[model samples]
Target chain A: MVLASGSMALATRTERTPSLIGSVWRSTVGKKAVMAVTGVIMLAYLVAHMLGNLKVFFGAGEFNHYGAWIRTIGEPFLHHKWFLWIARVVLGSAVVLHGVAAFQLSRRDLAARPAKYAHARRRASYATRTMRWGGVILALFIVWHILDLTTLTVNPNAEEGRPYENLVASFDRPPVTALYIVAMLALGLHIRHGFWSAAQTLGANSPRRDRLFKVLANALALLLTCGFIAVPVGVMTGVVS
Target chain B: MNLTLRIWRQRTADAAGAMTSYEVSGISEDMSFLEMLDHLNEELILAGDEPVAFDHDCREGICGACGMVINGQAHGPERTTTCQLHMRHFADGDTVDVEPWRAAAFPVVKDLVVDRSAFDRVIGSGGYVSVPTGSAPEAHATPVPKPVADLAFEHAECIGCGACVAACPNGSAMLFTSAKVVHLNALPQGAPERESRVLGMVGAMDAEGFGGCTNTGECATACPKGIPLQSIATMNREFLRASLRGGRGA
Candidate 1:
């Protein structure tokens, strides 16, 4: 009997399959924990990144100093090598972790029940279902901004001018500014739901604290969304330049 | 008063159904929605037709037995259950389009009736104190705080009506499930079984074929009892904590 049991266990092991993995990947609890943890990390990153980016309003010296300061969080080894290497590893890994979790979650979500676009009933929430679309738009905006501001010098790039002028120039176009505004609106909506949800995912909200957390999440989403939107609108309308 | 009701009639699970219009006249403006439904049944019986099969008990709105989407809104436009919805909110010649709650999990059993036993299964999975029926202690044995008691009462107000479920596009019952979870877990007595209760109920909700919540917030908006959506989040957090800590049956 012991030999039979041992052989059965061995047989199962020999034919090893990831059916357990598959099930876990598809479960509400499993998928949600991934979302909550990744979401919390990303949220923290956003706060710090947004605060850092706001340095431009303080002037160029401050702006570049902030950028350089940010750049140095990576390059503590300063031999021109190890300092930024460790930071690069950490930042890159975090992004990868967040991206992988988000991608897997969205895919499982899509696969859990197939929605045929053929009948395409528009019954879903404006905020709940648009995260995918918003993610796309935000990605595009980031690429454009990076290319224009950092990498490939656009025609509007002024070498000696403040970062402020460059931002104004970027949003001077109605189309781009409008796009940014829309993206901010979407981001705000996404984050408004995401914060409390993330906390819930992490098991941080109690009955006593749940309402308070949601209010705080809404306030933060609103403030950041409004902050991001204001810059583009200000630039486009010549309120700032 | 006269009312026009366009009800959904599906013959079988796979059968095609449509909005069949019925005209009801001489209704009292003070009649409860179920009472009005009774009048319709009475008229149908007179005409020798099959009466609409809808669930109702204790037409006073506490049973959560009565549910139908009245005019695209769950439990009508009122912030009360269907049994509590009065005709006073309507005018003399108002036309109301009534339909059963639409969700894959809640299949139509007939006209205006849904198989809400999915909820029962979720409840049965372990939405209980687990104490033996006769083992209940004195009411004041624990001396629960008033605020906690009040919140528990609010959650306990959930008649398990599935109004929140009806309003959710995903057809999620997070609000209902969460309310039950919060109701029991809020009390000192129910805390011993909190972990198992949350884990079992949520699993049962999924197993019974409810959709996942994406936090549209419509469920709260449509809830007759005004069961807040945050309770869903609280359940969410609870479920997460339990799962992380190696809870009952994963």
Candidate 2:
């Protein structure tokens, strides 16, 4: 019997099929964790971007210099615009991951409730309900925003180095300004629910901390919305040009 | 009092269902929601018609057996089990919509009866402790903190009624799953399998085809047991801890 057991022990060993990371990404809870992490990364970037955008109110020279200074960040260790490119890569990856997880989760959610209640009633808050549509709007806005500002592709008065003039040119038209306003509002609504949701997903929210997280979410959403909209409103009123 | 009921009527599991209207008269305001339904069923049975089929075990709210979406709300508007919801909340001539719990994991069996064995599977995964079988130990032999016991008891109130699934827009079972996970995980008795318990139950939940949570708060709001939404957060914390510690071998 000992000899037989020893012989059986020599058989090929098997490793776990799905690795820890593989299972984590595949599981719904883990996918939500991914969304939460990536959402925080993008949110941090937006705060910086919004602050940088506010530099335009100080006049063209300061704003343009601020834009140029960002390219030269990490001066000696990193080459010119390397920091910008790196940030773009990180932010782009965050966006893709956030979007893919959201898409898959949304599909699963819809499929889970195939039969709608006959006595249809409105469910969830307005911000919660608008999350999907707002995410799509934000995704589209990112593309258009890159084209108009970063790449100088769609800006009517495109120039290589003058971000301040470019900003004024993009917001000059009423339709463009209106679109910006609508997108900013959508951004606000998205952040309103998203920040609190991220806290919950990350296990940071408790019954005691719930109120504080809600207040922070509301404050962040309101601040970003008003700050971004102020730019186009300024352009419309001839304050930045 | 007279009332109109637009109850979902399906012959079998595969049969197409619809809202079949029936007028029920002489319903006393003191009658529970299930009692009113019983009144309707009695009339139908007397008329030589197929009586409405529903699930009800204890007729008491504690059993967690009776459940139906009453007017688009799970277990009705009063935030209690269907068996406990009194008819006084409704007025004469009111129309009520009764439907079974809706979720991919919970399929309709008959009229207002859903197959909730998915929850059983989830529970079977890891919702228990492996204690040594013998004569029971002395009462205070295993010391437990008062707060910890209270927390465990709080989550232990879950009746497995699936109201959370019905109320959730996404039909997510996170609330239900979290309640079980938290209830067991918080206790010292559940310590031996803490990591494995969370990993196993969460895996089973996903396998059951229940939706992922979106933190909509609807599930907690509609919960007849009043299980807090924070339970899911605690489960999330547990899951992350288990995953980080590599809950593979156990």
How well does each candidate superpose onto the true structure, as a TM-score?
Answer: 0.78, 0.97
Alpha-carbon RMSD of each model? 5.6, 1.9
What fraction of the true interface does each of the listed models get right, in terms of native contacts kept? Answer: 0.17, 0.61
Model 1, position A123, has a per-residue lDDT of 52
**Candidate 1 global Cα RMSD:** 5.6
**Model 1 alpha-carbon miss at residue A167, Å:** 5.7
| Pairs of residues clashing in candidate 1 | A74-A83, A74-A84, A75-A83, A75-A84, A76-A83, A77-A83
Residue-level lDDT tens digits of model 2 in A8-45: 77764433335678768888998999999999999899
In candidate 2, residue A36 scores what lDDT? 93
**Residue B125's lDDT in candidate 2:** 89
State model 2's lDDT: 0.91
- How does model 1 fare in lDDT? 0.73
Worst 10 residues of 1 chain B by lDDT: B241-250
Error of 1 at B84 (Å): 2.1
Candidate 2 residue runs with Cα over 4 Å from true position: A1-17, B248-250
